[model samples]
Target chain A: MLPYGLVTIEDRVARLLTELPPNPQFPTQGATLFVDLARRQVRQAYTPRRIIETFLAGRGANMFYLYRLLDESLDPIDPSVPLIFGSGVLTGIVPSAARGNATSWSPESGVLMDSNAGDYFPSFLKMNGIDHLVIYGRADAWTVLWLGDGQVEFRDATPYLGLDNIDMRDRIATDLGGTWTRDLAMANITRAGENQVLTSAIMAGPKACYARGGPGAKMGSLKMKAIVVQGQTHDFETAQPYKQYNKEIATKLLNTSVVKNALRTMGTPFLYRPSRVLGAMGTKNNQETTWTDRLDAENITPYRPGMAGCFRCPVNCRPLNQLNDDQADRYGRGDGPEYVTLGKFGPNVGIDQVEPVIRLNNICNDLGLDTASTGSAIAWAMELYQRGIVSKSDTGGLELTWGDAELVERLLFAMSHREGFGNVLADSTRAIERGHYPTEARKYCMAVKGLMQSDPHDARILKAFALGLAVSTRGMDHLRNRVTLEINARINDDPGFKAKLYGGPVSAQPNNYETKERAVRVCENIYGVGDAVGMCRFTTKLFNSPSLPGLEEFSSQIANVTGLEFDADVLDRIGLNIMGVERLINHRLGVRRSDDTLPDRWFDEEITVGAYKTEKIDRQEFDAMLSRFYAISGLSDEGVPAEAWRQELELVLSGPA
Target chain B: MSITVRLPTTLQTSGQDSLTITEPVENIAELVRVLRRQLPGFPAQWDDSMLNFSVNDEVVLHRAEERVLASGDVVEIILALSGGTPVPRSAC
Candidate 1:
């Protein structure tokens, strides 16, 4: 049980009603499709923002992300309750407006969480006229929710139980009628989800995936295989009225932004060498920071097929890796070997071969496993083996050695198939806690809450990211606040822009823990705007680069698209409101000061690498930063939001039903 | 005088990570001549490429070849496509 586990649903509702403003109509309007599997009933509820505020209270991405958290599903560990898929209000209305959220109680974190993906899935859902799809109750057997233009059908999914995500997609497509249509979008989990692996990731469409949190395991428990939505014969709705103007401006901005275009050209593999060069690559489960430059971007470019982007996104950062080699003959090709996978599977696990890296990436995609968590799991085990904490006997006679890409490949399959040693590894953080590793080995496990760390940029190097991961509602996530990634030369060189960006140039260093909390706070608010607005952070000017839009620029863009007359201040308030809901959800899930912390390794030890050879977080300084963070968030010392926060935001929480 | 130029993956076709141009060059054409001479026909690869040059973090997006370099100045020729780190999958 959680420390705040006793915080009941009723108590939460009462607190919500106490804190929220009087019921006001939501800024946007849409129909919520509610599906009750047990009752065999599907209902549509036109819940305006006022009613949503009474119960959940949010605008775009925040509402979908936080609503499930506000109720009994707040800490859903194999919950028999509800799971929701929410599209942002402006989803399908702009380029790169392709992210939809799988908002539910995560089996990984045991709290209200979201696993988000960018693709045409959200677009198709919007075209189908549904903003949110809420699934609850239990089915007697395996089922698939065939959600089309105007109809919902519950079909049996028992036949596709053991197939991998790729195969399942093909089978489902054939079942729905053979030819692939541009109109359909599908999300499914493979055997990993079926076995309820803690790191199960949901694969959406063919390439895009919500690759964090084992919410797929929740679907596994429900005996649900996939949720496929097809648009009714019409093309995806365009952002009309201002469609041409919006596209022209957006295209101009995207075209002019060298960063955005570079991503589309090089894909994410470009960061492999640079990350190591910068000493930010998490090597050997973060026991080391840098590795040889041989495995960098140049090595991986040989296998590129072209660039791949999300449905509406003009920026294609996912590199399409096409391999015709013998192993590639087996694993074939897919989108990635992204920096996270390349970082973890490459340096984090001590492997460097680009071919194996690409293969490992495809393996995870097919199995519907989260590469970040899977790589971390293997790396942790390898660390244990390196220290004699775990033996070959423990790993079923397989040597858990570093740089053994083949072994890593075997371990991935083992976990996916629940094979001997894989079963032990698949148990997640508990595998270590349950004495799988020597208790002393816990310090090296680099996890926040229960989920494994996304290991490209180590927290010791990036303090803002460290704090962001520690407090993010969806466990340790980088995308939750993309601003921390902007400790680049651009910010370092320009003091005027730096002053406007962070506090000033003096506080802009990655190692500057004093003002890092300020950056994190700023990033959290603006990223919330992106999530709520359905825009990707990479394109945003606030977090990644100053060349992009800030609050005022974004407000104008929203106005241009939705015809909503929101300014920077209004948008900032909306962002803060979204963040408030997220914090409260985490709070209700039993998050407190103790949980809002980092592993001892980060605070106690200095990074042993280039540039940061003498760097480590000052524990006292970090604590003060935390205090400042809470203060900036308008929360108490305990991280509880002040009632004044609710009053100012006009949040009126509804009591009971 | 040695001026260091960091070669991105696209420009590093010869597997050289970085090139140090000791010969003096005044303009982009001179720099292109040096590159063509050094790597032999590599400058032709620049056609249809969205490449930009940066001198000590200052992006000289236009006429970078024509841009003058100071002695011991660090220059980065980045593929305007994948400019270091923008958005990685699970961007940190």
Candidate 2:
């Protein structure tokens, strides 16, 4: 293993060895393990050019590295490609919203699932003396890695199988002092991971989770149970020159209006009203305008829940609430009931009661299910009930009525256990569509490219969001790119002024589509930069925080931390490099543009209410948007990576073609 | 005469203790003019510019040129656009 730093890895390991009782669970082959330093790969000497290049290239670079380590012949479904957990140079050190990213050829969209779960991996890995950990090859038995001080101890955790996420978290917390914050440690999978359900997620925090692409199931299939890394409190260190830079950035972030207003006050639940007004909040399986009168009925407004935040994030968006009734005993009081969960579980299912929604949120959390997908599935069932397709008999005498909290809670239980009709629902809308409801299944699935869609919002209303969803590697996810802010700002402020800036006919009032192609390109770059730096998108988009402006600054931070110098362009190259490599992997696995498609209902039926009332997204327009997106992204017309882009990124162009 | 304005849950904590704010009024426009004096920094206006008004739970369509308000009427001003966080429209 490489030397740790002012404190060498060997010395740190020896210190840890002295503290813990001798246990055989520690890996015997310590020589094979090594820390791959990422500081040199992320720093830069120049500023302006490096900043742009880093934004353009960082995401691809990470993807390329991950692809090289995986089997090229296997598809995303083959369970061979390794899930690479990465942290950017800014992680652990920079106090803004730096986070960790998970990159893998997804089983959900058969593309790259580049997602940020929370701050645990970023901060923990930094303290453990590393920036990224490429976890490859399946273990023969269920195992867990305890990354602490300087050494990584691999323990056989087979006995902990079948435990829920909450139980796993509780057990881990108890085992390693109850004071260990959830932001510092994460339990990837519990019972749901063991089941290997495609829709399963790796639950984090009290309510935060990496929900898309079944990473939890992937862990189960590999027989890898969980990995917990705890950072030492005294690990914060900074070299000369760059120490002042870090302090200045933190000061600017605290004073920014974006941090004080947009995120701090509303949290993520703020998306509900705008989405509902725009007719994007999917209701009744995207078949109706509104779900219930619950937005007003439940009094679900934003309120502070004391001091709750991720590893160094100032914008504490997670709202904590106390339940003083009988349900509080069974379900512990903690964070969340975010907009997506509340919208899908409450209003979308025809219920407006906040209490039941909270209960359902807790149930999904303990069971380790993706609330977005679970709620979407329930909404689909509700639609099925309304259409007379599913009745009391299908639901085992449970009335699938709208606004029935009791039935909603029961369904959540059934879905998690895979009991009764829950077996069919557990397989996800994609699988369900392919099985029983082939002809009409796509209508209710509300997915794009096989991954289930997030909270309801019509892409057509906001062109940037629509295009982002269309071209997103992992189906209809929004975090991949968020250009909706620009669109929203324009509409909310001055339509005429925005129209001029966007460059189109002022009288025509071109919808989000007019500038979608360009907006999506920029958004992709922004997302790439955020992922590479280990920063949350909300920090940039919502809080308006500026990251390292150029490579010199990035390198300065890295040089101070890891004593390494890297070109800024190298960081930008990382994002594209990762995306190109993942696309190549997907192509080998047989994922194509034809596979990237929205639900049929979006194209066929007209929305009857809200901003997009009486409008339906034209398939032709959507196709045009995708074509433009792919072309700009350096992908071929067929949505495959072009040979030039792949060659430039140093990824092997050889694949299905 | 006077009209009372009810604050939504989000704005209840803004030192507006009572459920309703009473102000003298003539018409929707005049009532808003009166409210500006009553509640400073209230982020709303009463121009015939697509303003939606409700009196005692019933929607009132007021023309910019002709609409008028009477005493003892409970008037609620609804912003055309909504969502994000939970800040009041005036605060936004």
Candidate 3:
């Protein structure tokens, strides 16, 4: 009894039988695409009885698709396996920030990780008369997939291969023969992908990037050169129901003055000071708990003109600034030394000057290198040099001195080209730890689960964030569980209000041990939903929009979008399902609770300078928080989500959680 | 005879985007009081405990009580937390 004009299974099967090639990749069994008349296209469709049911059902569907695509091998550890990008029912149609998600086997953490970008992809796909694109297997040569209006063409882009992101973008625009507009089309990857850098990211829009887990490298490994999507319009279908929903949410979001103010003014960079002040900004290879006063003074003083932002984003946090006269002459303009870049490249490398950090950020961006990983690797090298494990002879006579801009520039170039010492540094701190200087390298490698830390938020003042990073599928990422709200609340002048929001007394602060478990759990669950839908966490986290919805609201959005009567409980189950499947993926990969831990220095050393001096996160408290987090997440004592949780998610038994 | 009182980045817009202005004051406290008269909301944004007034790059943390202001001292009232919060007025 579905809508009559909707593409039915019979119709699609008939079309496929006639039109599909002998080597088509669609799974013949265990999955079916349905044409919901209301939706007007063929898509993987399911109806769950409750929130838990939907979660389990959706995750089961995705896992089944993943396994079938991988030739029925259920090993998550297999690097050759394809990454399945899935969106929850509410994804594109939802008025809130909840939008799109990317699910892949993470090379960094060696587990299935889900990360969210912005809403552009989901909305575009929906508008294009498609639900999802299941990318399977590696390509044989450097190729670009152009999904234009009503046609998808695969072109050989070997000529543009080995180019950096900025150049690649320019080349694509020139070849495509149009002025590229930011009206929700897709393009990503560069020569960094060609190099197969594990931390390399695909840049989209001007600043929006599919940053985590080397999607670019994955594309490069497949011999896929680039993906150019065009003809996608920004306008959504304005049905009566859609109009009503958009109006209500838009009115609510615009009405909230504080939310609007915070986003429109400071953007995500506001966290820089708070994180630094609270001793959370990772510094000196995560060895330094707080940045020096001089470092802060140099970085934050410049009054730059003009603001930049992602497509359709109201908060223009990206600052286009001029550093020194030389830099202005070179790059012409610089794209932000944003919080992560500033903290990672500046204080982490022991550089106190803002201009150098700005230059370093621009170089990394232009070279298509991840600043966080790049900075951490360089910091490790510096530490090794200082400790005599690495000498001037090792560095080719270049002094790895703190606050030296010239040394930083040389090292960055060396790392990019994999030249001399840069070859060793290019492999990341984790790889370096396994190399000859294990003891010295291990002391400075500031990463959890192989991925380097992002943000300068001190783990001591922000224990929940530390715990989240420890347990994140992609190693030490801030997005998995951004505990900024809890930290901000605890640090506010109003102790009673802070206690009310975070659930504790002033002295027994949530920033301390007592409340970290619950805090992380809430953040993870909300973020998990965001990831499943592929929404940007910045819009959700900073804007304080109704992105982190409870089960009922999630269901309502899905119901509104697809015209499916999904229950509220079904939405909650979807989150549980995604987490459970990811845990199983990690388990299959041999990841255990021991893998979920912070570097030793975070526990042993106290912050020596800045506002929160002498503060250190306690190891016992961190462990206790992990235990509680696992229990609440329906995971085992070993930090694996339980079988019952898996069953609740309705995923087929592939392996242990 | 008066000394020039320098404004912080946040309040620079109100003083016609000028960094320094001639103000009739004998001490730092008097200068602050004069600044408050000129700018109504200046004192509320500052914390006295953390406030460190400077004169030509020198810390005058305790100089409000002991040191008398000279005609051309180049007094600067620097807020420790200027960059931390979003300033309402434009730095333009």
Listed in order, the DockQ scores are 0.09, 0.09, 0.05
Give the candidate order by descending TM-score. Answer: 1, 2, 3
| Count of clashes, each model | 14, 35, 25
Model 1 misplacement above 4 A? A1-29, A51-75, A178-181, A232-240, A325-328, A433-438, A502-506, A560-563, A646-651, A655-657, B9-18, B21-92
Give the candidate number with the greatest lDDT.
Answer: 1
Q: List ranges where model 2 is wrong by over 4 Å.
A: A1-62, A72-79, A182-184, A235-243, A291-293, A296-298, A301-304, A325-328, A388-399, A433-439, A486-512, A542-582, A651-657, B1-92
TM-score for each predicted model, relative to the true structure: 0.85, 0.77, 0.75
Tell me the spans in candidate 3 whose CA falls farther than 4 Å from its real position.
Answer: A1-53, A56-79, A86-99, A119-123, A182-184, A238-240, A251-262, A292-303, A322-330, A433-436, A489-511, A541-556, A564-573, A650-657, B1-92
- Go through the candidates in order and give each one's C-alpha lDDT: 0.66, 0.56, 0.55
The best candidate by TM-score is 1
Shift of residue A39 alpha carbon in model 2, Å: 30
Task: After the best TM-score superposition of candidate 2, give how far the Cα of residue A572 lies from its true spot, in angstroms.
Answer: 6.4
Summarize candidate 1's per-residue lDDT along A136-200 as a digit string, tens digits. 65678878888875789998888888989778888887878633337678888889988888788
